[model samples]
Target chain A: MKAPAIDKKVLYAYLEEIKDPEIPVLSIIDLGIVRDVVMNEEGELDVTITATYTGCPAMDMIAAAIRVEMHTLGFKKVNIRYAISPAWTTEWMSKEGKRKLKEYGIAAPDKRFSIPADGVECPRCNSVNTRLISEFGSTACKALYQCNDCMEPFDYFKCH
Target chain B: MSESLINYTLHLADNALILGQRNSEWCGHGPVLEQDIAITNISLDLIGQARSLYQYAAEKMNAAAGKEHPAVTEDTLAYYRTEREFKNCLLTEQPRGDWAQTVLRQFFFSTYQYYLYQQLQQYADTNLAAIAEKSLKEVSYHLRWSSEWVIRLGDGTDESNRRMKEAVNELWRYTGELFVPAPYEKELGIDPGSMQADWMKKVSAVFEEATLQVPEKIFMQTGGKTGVHSEHLGYILTELQYVQRTYPGCEW
Candidate 1:
């Protein structure tokens, strides 16, 4: 049986439902991985995502999850393409998304392009006194850091 | 000179090749899903670096042998060689003891690589310099990640501190090899001496933050550059080569 037609708006909503497994509060759309959602005349849904890193293992899972979620929502023909160039940067994060990250205890990345030569600032207390603890944090996309003021260790989304 | 250049390149490639294989083992076994993905990311980066270095070395070998593309590509050199023929430094061959150990390993290796690549960026050879310039950025992040973990684990609770110390002690012996200049480095005009002091300064600064003592022992285990390797090399090669060995000349 042919799958029922789906609209771009509905497809986007369905994608919004798929949250980042790491930070559950943030959806792929919020993370900027869900680039553009388009529905072709054939009723097929095409989703483009930019991976945080080239070999990010989550790309496969994320793609599969998107497909499964869309199929469950009645869109069977789903195409997920990974856009490598123009690469994903922290700049893609939405303001609301940054706030969600702060609430989650992880610091939102510095929006400024001219990142200091020393290191990034701590998201928790807005302290540049912070120090990078590890490059490989809880995830590939984050680096471990400690806010000296808050005295709490947190993950900083490493700018690609 | 070319011989030593090949040797030095193999040394760099082996560290990355072996460590990448080890890190890949954590594909599904990471403490957390995010951590698992992170380790894989690091693994891919190291593997990519290894491939680039190996390809360059292979090209040099082909030129010396008066052939195009040589009889073997980088993969052949990486997988088909015996343990004794493998030239990665001793530190990379060490087992991934735990999360602490793995982080410590990354810390030490990345720190050295960051400085090494930075200096390499000035090499007279344009291709080598270009590769170094590109890799420096990636290595910088790796170093930062490793350094952050060192501080966290070192200053953490008694259990973590103890584990971090133990990990450092276990890996310290291998640290010596990083500074020993391979003959090819000198012959190729890649004097690593300038970066040695700088690397030491940065490494000590990180160690201080971690509250760990830098082991003062001067003796270092060597031989990777000369194709003499540790016992672990055999097992590492077997695992790394299994697929390629089973299907020679296979391409995806």
Candidate 2:
């Protein structure tokens, strides 16, 4: 007898438990790294993922986490496939993920490239008086910004 | 055909890795703390790109050669390759002479990559196309950032302009090697030579705004593509492969 196919809902639930190694507040599902999930002919789960950035060190950790999570979910074997086309964008980040990032003191990716007349809003003080400190930040996926009102340095997940 | 494809992929990976290593030298030595972080961050991205390409190359090599014991891996390909086996362009191996040289080198290379990746996104090879698509986004930022610096340096004060001009005179010769495709690149389906007109147009536009001249009639240097690199590559490999050479299979 073949193993029962894991439903999409259950698969997502399991994936949601695996938070980004770098941004613990955001789960891979909400972050849009989890693209698609399917069951292969052998009744084994196949998960497709895309890298947020080319050189994200967290990728390996995420893959390992997936294996561990699948094992706990009673799936003995899972195939993680990486897809790079139709490249990942900030738009894929869930609304809840953005909220969590803001609450975590890191600004979620902002879609607008043009600087508003007001300024970038600070995740901490909610003040639209922030300035870009550097085009890059602590990680390859973020840029450094400073809150003029709160005077705190923060990382902004780059819009890429 | 497959051999050419592997060589072509390795050529690109080597370009990214060597330039990334050179850029990382500015880690503590950047003109400013923020800029220092910026360059190194770019370096990380480049190295990240190298890792992906190397992984692809290694997979292809393993599949083709069917090696069993001591299976081929990205590390072995990166750390164990001889200097003559490197396929990076000569321009990437050039020393980071000064801020101007560093910035200019990045600007030129990023511009080339921007166009190259754009063309590659539609390539017949799905894997290469995917890598190009993923890389184009990061390359876009690098191009914009470096171009801005080029303008700033070229149009800045007399001293700054002098240094930028000096960099141009020294580095312009290496730019030619990028467009002249080698045997491997020729077999890879796309013609970098065809993109030269557009590349020159954008570069000229940038230099014009900066009131700088794109040196005319310089003797263009070539030969890094065929593993005929200058003295710089050996030095880079010595430091880069040292840890791996000293301790085989050392995990970081």
- Per-candidate TM equals 0.65, 0.94
**For candidate 2, the TM-score of chain A alone relative to the native chain A:** 0.93
lDDT of 2 by residue, B77-154 (tens): 899999999999999999999999999999999999999999988888888888999999999888988998999999
**In lDDT terms, how accurate is model 1?**
0.76
In candidate 1, clashing pairs total 8
Worst 10 residues of 1 chain A by lDDT: A111-120
Model 2 residue A123 lDDT score:
88
Instruction: Give lDDT: candidate 2, residue A20.
Output: 93
Two-chain DockQ for each candidate model: 0.11, 0.71
Model 1 over residues B22-112: C-alpha lDDT tens digits? 8788889987765686777789878877876788888788888875444757878887888877778788887888999999988888888
Q: Which lDDT values do the candidates have, in the order given?
A: 0.76, 0.89
Candidate 1 lDDT for residue A74: 76
